[model samples]
Target: MRSVLVTGGAGFIGANLVLELQNRYPDAWIVVVDDFRSGHFSNLEGFRGDCIASNVAELRLSERFRDGTFDAIFHLASITDTTDHDQLRQVRDNVESFRMLLNWASRDQTPVVYASSAATYGKAQSVMTEATDASPQNVYAFSKVQLDNLARYYHQQHPAWKIVGLRYFNVYGPREAHKGHASSMIFQLFQQMAAGKRPRIFTDGEQRRDFVYVKDVVAATLAALMAPDSRIYNIGSGASASFNQIVAGLNKALGTQLEPDYFENPYPFYQNFTEADISLARKELEYQPAFDLDRGIHDYVDWLQKERSS
Candidate 1:
């Protein structure tokens, strides 16, 4: 059986990716690692695989480091919560864990396909291409940029190691229950509307994002894993939508005419009027996002309703 290790397999994207892999590669031996610090056990419900609830950095110190060999490693574990963590903590947890994984992967010569963030392209005037115009706005983005730099360094230093860093846009979908403050606007809107409340949107609801669905993100990740090349790719729909558009979509899906409560933008945030140039991924990985914003929002809202009812 093909063996793979997903570092944050119990979190939002990780859990969805695990389910997708299980369906696609039935005989694959999937090992999931999550600390449950922010990840939830409920996300792994009905999953049929080996699961280890532990920190990735701690796992690097164990005997499994020598015994296990994986066809590919998906490093998704990180301090993704922008508000809950400070810069130093984000670096320590994210950069340090990634460093340990890279060190081990380099020694084992194992292929790594990891999650990078669109936040790395913070406040870029134009679309974020493959170039190194990384204006990271926050700790989370800074950590991801650090990983991308590390991947580039490793690829240059050790030509044998295959590493692909996927710069993921705003990802949203089912099984993302623990996302809390970091959850997508769609999910948050669903929850608010369900409770008969209008969802609050920030910054006059004008800030835009390249909101890629979780399934598409997983497909891109899998493609990166199977691809032979070692390069950074932007995984997004290449289309942009404002917060107003998202709220409108959700209202349509839920059959309600609720308006969003507008608020001032919080934090020293990157008001990202951003879209991905997914040309490289299209040319190389044959990756194209299948879901549009309205369709994705409808599907997510339906799932959220069912999940909440259950």
Candidate 2:
């Protein structure tokens, strides 16, 4: 059976991807490796797989590294906190963990498909293309950029390795539990609204993001795993919508006329008029995003409401 190792398999995106893979590739063995620092066991509640709860960097040095040779490795483990102030920790967890995974993949000659971030395109003034001129605004973006550089370096040195990096846009969906600070805006808004509280949105509701659903991301990721060449692709809806649009969708779904309370921007966060150029993914991987912003938000809100009641 084809075995695959998914680092950070308990995270929002990682957990969703693991479940999707389990359904799609039932005969294949899925090994989940996570540190559970930012991730949680609750995220893998229904997962039935060989899961090793450990730091991915430490796992690289373990006997499993030598004994088990995976057909593919999905390196999703990283310090995903964009607001984290610890630069050193971000580097240690995101960059160092990725380096260790790359080293192991290089040794085993396994294909690697890893998660990069749209944050790498910090304060994008122009259109974001697959260029190396990354202006990372935060430690998280910097760490991802560092990992992408490492992957490029390794690819140059060892052309035989298949390494693909995906720059994910704003991802949100079901199965993302209310993990307090780590939860998505959609989940947080739904929780607050369900509790008869007004959902607070940052900025004047004009701030935009290319909100891509988790299932679409999973499909793109799976496509990347099978692709022959190594390349980076932007996984998003290729469309941008204002925060007002999001709130409107939620209000429509919930049948509530709740006005969103807007707050001032805290930090000088990257408020780009963000939209993805997913032509590369469409052409290369035949990826078509199944959910638009309205549909995705409606689905999320409905799921959240049902989940909370249940």
Candidate 3:
């Protein structure tokens, strides 16, 4: 059986990816490394795999597994809380961990697929694309920019290495309850309306986002392994959805007619609009998002209700 390593396997997207990995590669030896700084144990409730509860940077990978042991390495571990403004801590944790992993994996030439972020695009005047220059507004996005740079540098030095970076758009799906405040607006709105509270949004509720479902993100991450070359690709729904539409979707899903509570936009750096240009991902990764806003909202709400009941 092949071995696969997933860092931050207990986190939101990580947990979903891990569960899917379990189903797809039943016989594969899967190991998870998470510090639980942001990840919760409940996220991995049904996951059947070896888990190392430690920081990725501190983890002694060589002592635990030999070089060439991991057939594929999915590096998802990072300080995901974008609100975190501590420049030094955020950059160190996010960038250094990947650096250590990449340096070690480079020896055996392990195929590494890592999570980048759409936040790197910041407030783009037009649709976000890989060709567009990055304008990071926060430390978290800046760290991801550094990750992309690192990946590109390594690829340049070793042309044969398969290191792929996926710039995830606004993702939402199962096993994300642990994120709490950082959870996707879809999940958060469902919760608010489920409790008979009006869904809240920024002023006018017209701010749009490319909310890609978590399953689609997983598919893109897996497809990255098949990339013909080491490169970065955007993983998103390829379409934008307004917050007002989200409220409407939630109302229909919950069988309620709660309107939105529009409040003033507080953060000056908030992105008013975001739409991913997924043409590169389409051509390179052969990725096609199966879940649109309506379908994804329905599917996610159904799962969320079941989780609450269970």
Q: Specify the highest-lDDT model's number.
A: 3
Scored by TM-score, the top model is 3
Q: List lDDT for all candidates, in order.
A: 0.85, 0.83, 0.91
Residue 76 of model 2 has an lDDT of: 91
RMSD of each: 1.5, 1.6, 1.0
> In model 2, where do residues sit more than 4 Å from their true spots?
none
Per-residue accuracy of model 3 over 228-250 as CA lDDT, tens digit each: 98989988999999999999988
Better of 1 and 3 by lDDT: 3
Candidate scoring better on TM-score of 1 and 3: 3
Compared with the true structure, what per-residue lDDT tens digits does model 2 show for residues 61-170?
54675677888888898887788969888888888888888876787668999999888888876556777368888888999999889988999989888899999988
Q: lDDT (0-100) at residue 305 of candidate 1?
A: 75
Report the lDDT tens digits of candidate 1 across residue range 95-194: 8888888888887778998999888888876787988489888878888889998898889989878899999988999887688878877778788987
Name the TM-score of candidate 2. 0.95
C-alpha positional error of residue 218 in candidate 3 after TM-score superposition, expressed in Å: 1.0
TM-score of each: 0.95, 0.95, 0.98
Cα misplacement distance, residue 204 of candidate 1 (Å): 1.7
Inter-residue clash pairs, candidate 1: none
For model 3 the TM-score comes to 0.98
